[model samples]
Target: SVNSIRRTSPTGGTSGLCFKKLNITTSSYRIIINRLDRKVTVNYRPARLPFSRHSLYVEDTGSMYLIHTPGGVSMQWYHSTGIMVLQYITRYNASVPTRGLCGCCDGNPEDDLKLPNGTVVREVGDMMLFLQAWRVHTTDETEHTRRVGDNCTTGDCSTCLSMLRQRAFTPCHSKVPPEQFCDIMWAGDLHYKDHQCDFLAAYVAVCYTHQVCISWRRHNFCPLRCPPGKEYQPCVSTCTSRTCLNREYYEETTCSFIREECVCRSGTILHRADSPYCVTEDRCVCTDNEGNPRAPGEVWNGSARSCCLYKCMENGSVVAVEPDCNSVPTPLCEREGEYVLDVLEEGACCPKKICECNMTICDSEAPPCDNGNRLVIGYSALSCCPEYRCECDPMACPPVSAPDCREDQFLVEVRGQKSCCYSYL
Candidate 1:
């Protein structure tokens, strides 16, 4: 069964992101988005060599936009083709799947993320800045197009293509020849066929599984999903082997049947801080020579006061910002007096009411007594409040004597008016 999920930001603005399976399904790609820092990292690894070149594409209809890469996020094979990372800073929130052609080129052998003014990005930082500037440019361009009443044609549009081409840049890592590491990265081992480990160490550093390996040949490469502050240690056998990943020689644990288990990555044990940083992918602390943690946003010359620290209030609780400030702070809803019902999961689309009052009951009680009936008040769990019912009282009202009236007919006062009705006949 093929499963796919698309997410949109309900808080309005263009802050939504989505994930989908591309045409090249054999290769695996992971998209990590940091909405706060406006950075998006796309990691791709092909099952085989000579992977197709794919560029990041976006289709921005007035409603939404999309991110597409023709082949995959892996930009290997060709020097100019491999650009797997993209980061953008935007004034307005970035939404996707809008109705316009806004994607990067994948098949172009000479492809490079550049700007219209011929600015080239040589490093990751430059790439981030370029993408941020591109977003502003495209947003302005889109607004202008909207004002002119021009229908934006989506899917392989010139505007998108131009932006993609202009904003193209060569990744810093492309300079490294894949031959030095390609075989180890893609060994095309058949043993891992049944296993679901994207099997590419490029994306996952280490993996552990319930099934143990038999002599390293029949290893069950189980993918490990680490919690915050931790990362996997890709289990590599020998350095000369085709799958070497430069992992540290940490003590291995014994799983079921005395099988070896890969150790999780960890940072140096800090003196004062008990919970030291878990050295993992996407995490590298800007530390001082003394091994003290330093803020990435702040410059450390000699003192700690210069360290940039974020003081944020999230959900009425003050907490330090995420490591490296690569994440957006979740908004907090003040809980004045009312009791809190439930908080939506972190990064959820809709704003969950942090606090809410008890269920309100109807002010007017007694169901109007009808047909010489008396009102009975009761509580209901379904309604979470009190409810009313009418019980018959034959002596309360006189019987209705009208043409074609049943012998059991009685006059019931409804809304202060007498009405003829059968009395339980």
Candidate 2:
């Protein structure tokens, strides 16, 4: 009965006998043959309606929900799908260990793989890869190329390779060894792009040999050791079989090296040890060498060489006499007076070179006497005028008068004419 449950259409009238007689004496309900013969129709219908049509009449009044909500369908789907895509696109198929296992599975363990000279390949590889990647990703192509070149040449890769090669050839290995070779290779590689490798190479050469070679094509000579103190002397000597001009030379002297300053010979000047060249001189005289009689302007040639006459001074004392102006001279002052005065006899004084008169004799002669008589007073003559009455002052004397022949008057020939003049008038 439950399985057969169904809804049926109502009878033809609104109040049919079946519906109205339900409360009238309530005859036993039964399907009678008489009702069947009266032409009664039966209708059956489904209890539940179809899903699409059933909800059409119902109002969807629930609160509206967003597709992008947190933990929503879209979010969950995206998260799951993204993870799966990433896994699919990965290069290495094997799962990488996150815990204790080593990253590299190759027999040449990253840590253990080293160059012949113990240069680590892993480090070099890493550097190379990093530089390549950076260059590829960067916008600046030239700069990126330069960077790549620098890393490749001077980086660990080149260094490791060089070191390995150096170690393999024991006999031909550099005295500096493979490590130094690696360093040099790296330096060269790094600086090569900039054309700075030459400088680096020079530096390396100097380090290995402890010497430097300089070239001056214009100069004909190269000096060996410098003079005693003049170490920066210009290169004047020929370069043939010469030592470096800056080289040090040992000398024996009677004076203690600790107490006395080192001096150069007559033909030489003191070239300091720190300078690059020795001051050129005829000869270097030793302290123990005897003092020769060097004239005012004479220079001391090396003992082996002849002493040459440099220049002569007519009046000046030669302070120093050497090959050139740089030589130290023995000062020679004229011994004219007891006092020794420094007179610039050779050089110009007041725009000209002239002998200066002796100070004592300057203006010594008295001006010519205007009277022209031999009555000039000698230096020893006694003073005729009193101290208060100077010779230059007006003198009190008898007034000149015409000759007058009086009883007490004395007439005498005055000057060239014979005239009677009053005396003491």
Candidate 3:
């Protein structure tokens, strides 16, 4: 049973907009409308009764109409319990029928033009007639909000009347309204903890004066770039050279500038083996092992000693010598040294061409030899060469040729003499 059905407003307004709701004893549903904000909030409750838990049925209907002087506008909408919804907009002017039964306004009347005498006149009473009708009915049940009222400001009925006048004259108005697109989409779905519900329907009307405007737009154009060694000069339709240095030249092909091929002033087309740069007159001429200028048909030795000098191998063939001399069987290990040349016979490999000390020879004096069992001890020098040596320590002492002394007398030995006994007291 729909027990408590009333309307209230948490935020009071002069426009007399009251939120309507159906309040049952155990559950209540309410709809809140903020006219100034053009927003609608709906609160709903599920059936609590055991048998009718899922059988709750609800519906809502809203209508608004205004007709006073110059024009009038009306909006209406109907919604069923989670089912179908219908909405439409109606407008009329002074020339139309008093009740606007056709739901359309008459032709746009002429605007008042002020003349020099301060009197207003109309060029034509009626020129163009226009009737705009918009209606939408959907059964898709995709929980959506439909705009039921045109935008209106908070004032008096006169404000709505002024909007009605603008809407009526919309077809004949000279100034274009600012271009507006649905940039913002508000979700009308009602949500509860785990329950999903739809906003069945809503209606609203707005009246206010506003200027017409169009949208802003422009085309996108990107600029191009020039190739390497080139500078782009706009409006000339061509890439220019950046004045290349040395043997570099600029080549412009297909609107882009690139470095020209390496070409030497000298007519020789052959290039050095190590580099791609063409051989120029200023460079040294290639030569053979005898230091003579190389002639045509001679194989160029890539492993030459100098940039253009070749060497003759032991086999009587001329070729570029290997850069690392240590690879040769008879490498030059040292220039001048007594120890270096003397020790080199140990191995055929080249001795290091650096100063070195003989580490096998020890420079310390020998220790005393043991009776018949001399042992070599390991002792090393403090020098950088750190020569290790062998030394022996005597473990035996000389035998004494004397008799033992008495208990009360101590035996004293004289320097460079034999031991003798003496009385102390």
Candidate 4:
């Protein structure tokens, strides 16, 4: 829904990534985001393709789908479209009523702009009023130049047209409109020219979705050069019909599913998924997990951490990474504590968090009560330091009244006041 989630760094830097999160009218699927580990999951499963280097090429479900468990709801995130097209594959409970920016989803177009107060803005002129009703109050920390949209600009915008003139994408003019896509490139040139390639790539991806294939790439511009003996294609079947590892037999999952990738054209077989190296049965190449090709019969050290030997073979069972150096179980003490994490080879899955109990916190050191205010042991989940602190009856100052706040909000306490424990919005 165009969140504009621009995260200006805590140090006040402008460098940050921004993306829009589209909300769908689905009831069953729940996305869990773990802020601590920066992990995103849907229905307790990974939301991305396994071992994908960029994490952009998700699983090929003939059509990429985010299948949620239990309620049977599923969706897919298109990496190229720059949008989350949530296709509700399952139906919600008939008795249950659903509502949001997408509206009730009960087949009514008039109630799409329904406010939080359950009042729908019927007049189109008052749409701004409806927007103001739902507008977030947070201050914008990102600069206007860093916004993720095209600020329609006027200049020599021949750069986007140049990519169009190339023979690779020359046939896609009538298939997909380039005016809106070119706006991003032209606007970006005036501010930051970095997004030119990105916008073009997204445009190509969107065109591909519409079954309009356009193989656009340049060595000097948005370069995604194919490795030796392999070439990038505008659109190709997602299934690997054959590979260097399997010269004989392989299952063709689907021929309709299409995507953009570097492929072995006509005669040669693919060495690996989009790797620069291509191969035949007589001259084979083994690609490590990181896409580096290893020569045939060459015993080279793979992407192993903490010392381990591995050789590239026909089977693509390879993994190597040293991510999360700080993830090891760390011990805290005046002197160095004992280490218990079992050292293993790289790219291990389902990693367990090695924890060591080193210390405990008990004393909170609560403030002393005033005169005539008897201290009594009390328990309140909302109160801070309640484990050690005691409550005061007949407050030192004056007894305070709890603030009237919304149910979704909690009372905020302030110190040193005549009306003790007074709260504010």
Top-lDDT candidate index: 4
How far residue 290's Cα lies from its native spot in candidate 3, in Å, is 27
Task: Compare the candidates by TM-score and give the number of the best one.
Answer: 4
- Compose the digit string of candidate 1's lDDT tens values, residues 275-382: 223343212334445444443344333324333334223222223443343243444434322354555444443334444535442454555776567777766543
Query: Which segments of candidate 3 are over 4 A away from where they belong?
Result: 1-319, 322-338, 341-352, 355-368, 372-405, 408-425
Backbone clashes counted, model 1 = 32
Ten-residue region with minimum lDDT total, candidate 1: 74-83
lDDT (Cα, tens digit) per residue for candidate 4, span 1-425: 23345444323443223443422222544454322222345556645422122112223232233323232333344322223333333365343354454456556677777888989988756766676676544333233343333345644456666655567665666766555556654554443344455456666666665677676665556655454676656576554436554466656664332556656667766554323345664445456545555654444454345333455454544434334446555443222222234444464432444433222332434566654344565444433233444454544556557778788998877654432344354
Model 4, residue 381: C-alpha shift (Å) = 78
Q: What lDDT is reached at residue 155 by model 1? A: 19
Instruction: At residue 410, give the lDDT of candidate 3.
Output: 69
- 1-425 per-residue lDDT for model 2 (tens digits): 00111112222212101111000011221111111111111122211211112111111000000011111111000110010001111232233221111123233455443333434445543555433332322222222122322333345554344433532234323444445655554443443423322223333333323222222111222122222333222112211111122224533222100111113334443332211223443222211134222223344433344433233243323333434433333443332322333433333121222233244632334433221122133321222221221121112233566577799777674421222222333
Each prediction's whole-model lDDT (CA): 0.32, 0.26, 0.26, 0.48
Model with the higher lDDT, candidate 1 or 2:
1
CA-RMSD of model 4? 23.7
| Pairs in steric clash, model 4 | 1-21, 66-75, 227-276
